[model samples]
Target: MSVDDGILEHMFESDFASADDKTVVAAIEECARAEAMLAARRLAATAELTARYTEPDEDRDHLAVDGWRMASAEISAAMRVGDRAASSQMCIAMALRERLPKVAALFAQGRLSAALVSTITWRTQLIVDSQIAQRIDTAIAQRAGEWGGLSVARLESAIDSLVDQHDPDARRRMREAAQNRDVRLGKRDDVTGTMSLWGRLSIADGELLKRRLAQLSSQVCKDDPRTAGQRRSEALGAIAANAEGLSCRCGSPDCPSAGQDDPRAAHFVINVITEANAPNTEPVPATPAESATAERAAGPVEPATEPQAAEPATERSKPRSAAALIIGGGLIPTPLLAELIKNGAKVQWVHKPPAAPETGYRPSGKTARFVRMRDMTCRFPGCTRPAEFCDLDHTTPSPAGATHPSNLKCLCRIHHLLKTFGGWGDQQHPDGTVLWTAPSGRTYFTHPGSRLFYPGWDTTTATLLVPTGPARHGDKGAMMPRRRRTRAQDRLRRIERERALNAIDRKRWAAPATTQPSRPPPQNDDPWKITTDANIDTTDTDPAPF
Candidate 1:
């Protein structure tokens, strides 16, 4: 081939590689750059539409301008996928053909957002049958002399009120049907389950059960670390060990052995046999080996540690504070510590902090308990996760600032990592709003209805009361009402909740941070768990039966 021919062939069939590490990296960077540019162009187009269509300076002419702007914005957004020139022609055609109000009063009065208003107008334009929106628009246009001075938002609101007055059930039916549709699509887990066993099962439990079963089906043949189901099964083995005494090996379903109903019995029996025969408990009063191991693990058991014996309750409840062990250390700041104390929090220590800037150091679990309870989820716009499942994100780093309640936010693992490590530029406003500037320079704000606020919890009615304190070292304070502290089982429940929630959020974004769902259906709506005071006791709840 000639030189030009060779060059053309190389460009089309480059051996640079379809999946080379360096080539893939470069491709990703280039794609990101392209996306950023496209987003910028979209924003610029929006700005132009606003400038050409909105007459913000003229109060009386505002409705007409708003109508024009709304139409332009809708057309522009829809045009993002099509030929811009053709979309522009269609937009101009519709703009000239339709008579829209000069000012949309409800919009100016804050009844709606610019995007929502534009969307409504766009929907009306694309409607093949419904003349309701068009009729409303025409009515508004006719009264431009009287309502022309009103805001676009106000105009929209007025139309809605008129529609509602004529047919109140119209909006209600639409809303209810939309909600029901969401519930059926597995998009809303709450409505699916709300009964004692059946109700909640139909709602959140059923969905969770489905997800768990799917995960198990995919994991059984893997060689990685044990699956969640295995861990839970093993933990239950410790509790269910004594249940076998009540069981009979009789073949009848009526026999207590029927309760076993082992799903993975073939493989599980072999594993159980291995565990049972691994080692036996030491014989007699005490064994030196067992004693030595206990001493090494927990130092020494003091003779005085034995408390006065008390009557045991019929039902034993799980422990409130899941701390591994309480230990002593030099005082951290009191304000910071008090916030934690006021919230029922447990800590697990690492003994020392990270020595390098590159190493990410998080607070022990005790601190996690505090921070997680404080902000509950990502303070970023539209993000949602419960505090218990969140990472304790320091709004400002130490050495530059102190660890105060205001400086902490509970973000899910994804948001935390994104803020700490990703190139996303973030800031917290003085008023506690969070703003994120995307790579495209589009600013996203988490304000009043955004993800920045934590719903304050009322835990006073519970047996475990987080103390009110003017804290001091050596303060014994109030002991927890119960001594049982292992909550690893409950931790699994939280993990499940996080997973379900992550899934929903992922669906919303069309791109998920993790494989899990964004938000699980609310626990209050689950059927299988004990529900008292709208709280689901996840501690003892079984995984939903698929």
Candidate 2:
């Protein structure tokens, strides 16, 4: 039955609870088939849109980078997505249309989902030979409908094996992942004053660090209140501070490491912005019994003279207010701020930001710092690359525009290229606001990310009276920077090299065994006797003597 006929029969059946189990199952199956068909239609439409923007003659040559980038920008604006995502859609669309006709047919018949089609296209990207690609496409399409129950890894392995048998050289090369090792700090979590730490390191270095942490974590006294995990966490902090070892919290005078300073400990600075005139409460003095109990439960405490006053019930019941802000970290609660201060955290007040923009092709260091602090991330809509890693692009090209804070905005490399070459236009306002115009003539506005965190800071700069001349058009003859070797050439060379190596290895494995020369028998018929007569005939079929 047709997918539309099935849908028409059950489209009004909203009361699934009253339906029989088989009927409900049938409805679900029909809906899934309908969804797949819809996804296929969407991909076809995307492919059509891409073709509309692409120059027909340039389609054969993938070097038409600007044409595809323009299409990506239009798709991005219309779909409310990033350029990378839009480009991915276009690539999948084109792959299905031009290279995987059999798979595309299955997708159109509602036997495959968009996600499955996407995977099929990506895994087959290395196949440059049209005949080989078509054969693989046909093979995959015949069995792809049964892959819905397979895990992603298993599915990839299945596809890879098929590709390998037909064209081993067409398999995607695994990159050197170790070369990309890096450490990164995740954004602040929902809990205040906390963030996640994750990274990749060489196996040897990771093991060494683990061993060091384990050694330091075990150095504390048995009476230490913290658990092994807590001790390891503290050890990491100790390492960061250049301390020799973690401090013992046993608080006993007889503890071997008591009353000693870590000479290796180095001073570290932390920037904190706090509200002026915050309430200050003196530490309450503890009795002798209370001190002992507190020491056993936590750690040692210093004696103080003043006692803290009790707050009213209403005030105590209210939620704790944020009293300070860490420079890169999130909000700090009042109690945590007090604890930080008690732990000898230094406090410094920052002066107001500069009011005027600087003059030059490059912004002054102070102005650059101010812009980074104000934006906090790239000003391109939907882009979240941190401001520190982005290029400070002029809203108006240099020479025509000044190096003012109002004109300078952060843009990552790809978006910067888009604005420079993909016919995108943008304007900046004095209040750190950016207005972007996509190639499709759609407009999007983005405000400073800092406004969400620091609403009180004044990011406004003086507006310049620079003249924006007639819109500059891209040179018709200009092309994207060419690679040393085109993709097709590179693929051909790599495949040939790999195939040559494989042939050598196969020849080595498949070589025929050579017959050994006949040995002379012992003259005296002694099995262990050695004989050196090369002319003696010992070619009998009998087994050799022991």
Candidate 3:
């Protein structure tokens, strides 16, 4: 029988239930080896496909824009993955094929797991010299089979040490990470009216923000019921809305901060869409003072602040018992929604979609807002980037593609680049549906993300008819934007700069301390300063009698 037939027969014939513990353990090891071999095969195939699409020309470097065009898109379609993921896979595949042949061989021999290979490739990516890379690869492969038990952190450190030994400059030193500091608001999860905050800030800025939050949290009266964490969260919100301070909820009549108008009260505008006659749709009192007094009479209450606008909610005329939708936040509980409106929050109603598509090349504000509300996220398949952060791409290049809602769709910058230069094409339909054609000729269909949340609302628009002819913005002579410095050049410069800084620190640390010279005796003043062997007193040999 062929190898495939034999493997299938063995797979069916295995009787794990009848096996002893030793046999079970051996079987598990065999399965792990098989998994590694399978992963190697997958990477090999990916490498082959990438080579086919991104073959280099003698006149131009493969690293240039032209060679990699459409390569990632092809991989993305074949693997049914996002563009970023496909590009990462391609990088790993190329690294194995061209730079780390020894490690790749170990992977193919079922001795190294996929995770280990990934870590090894990433840790050694800075080694620009092929000779050094090969040396490190061989060194790693020789012992990688014994590293199955190592955690991810340990594995990375082990690989890094090897690279550092061979080429100290190539060691991955990411001191520039502070330059990438950012803050992000997470999508709402199951928690009602709450979302998580995530951020990476400079050390100084982070400490400052933390101290500021703590100070604000302490502004509340001692009897406030909220926990420290909750108080901090409220304080962050207060800072975001430019509010004066958190209101004290101690229910004390003589509280000093009572009756003070919140400067932030008018700044908070909440957009909520609800059925006009929906039950329990009571509005909060018109003023913060009135709302606070009412809550006090009812006993201690949860801290209240003006609600920020919910992301645009789906408009529906029919009455239903569904909870109110906060535009960007998520679902708000009915009681909480009522309380927010009572706390001097401004309410704006979104009753319907934009009336019509605009005539200008750029979409009007109304059209842009409507598109964001309808799509909710990027229209690219498997991409979940929020529409608010995406560019409104023209399905067909503009002028040929009108500024109509049907022709405009949300695409994050990366995916937008793919459609523009990566040989990917897309069609946008009247109902916010997108049909994508990747470089590999596979097609994917995606609908407006809002359809999943607001099923009853209509997102349909006027149908756009694509003109039949050559594209106005064809990619005949297109080139991907070149970087100021290539990745290899940038890596070399960064390594040199960082190593020089390190050398300065090392020299300072290792240098011997300077000693002050002994002062000379004053001229003709102290005879004890000069000593000679003859001047020693032999009479002192006898012990002194006391």
Backbone clash count for every predicted candidate, in the order shown: 43, 0, 6
379-442 per-residue lDDT for model 2 (tens digits): 7776666666789998887767778888888887777877776667898998889888886678
- In angstroms, give how far residue 526 of model 3 lies from its true place: 8.3
Candidates in descending lDDT order: 3, 2, 1
Q: Candidate 1 regions off by >4 Å?
A: 1-119, 125-360, 379-384, 388-391, 398-407, 412-546
lDDT of 3: 0.68
Weakest lDDT window of 10 consecutive positions for candidate 1: 267-276
Q: TM-scores across all candidates?
A: 0.24, 0.63, 0.70
RMSD of each: 31.1, 11.0, 10.3
Poorest lDDT segment (10 consecutive residues) of candidate 2: 304-313
lDDT of each: 0.36, 0.66, 0.68
- lDDT (tens digit, per residue) of candidate 1 on 237-309: 3233322222122345554334443322111100000011223222122122221111111111222111110
Pairs of residues clashing in candidate 2: none
Q: What's model 2's TM-score?
A: 0.63
- Better TM-score candidate (1, 3): 3
lDDT of 3 by residue, 1-546 (tens): 256978777877886757899999998999999999998998998898878866645322322444444666666656667767877888899899988998999899999898888888887776668888888888988888888899888888888788878987667655468857889886536466677788799999999999999998998888888999998988887797677688776767788656544434444444433222323333333343222111112212212232222332222222233345443346656555545545554554323344355678988765665577677777877766677678999898878878877888888887777778667889888888988987667898889876777666666777667688877674443455655654445557975776666456556767988685565334556654433345487664754454
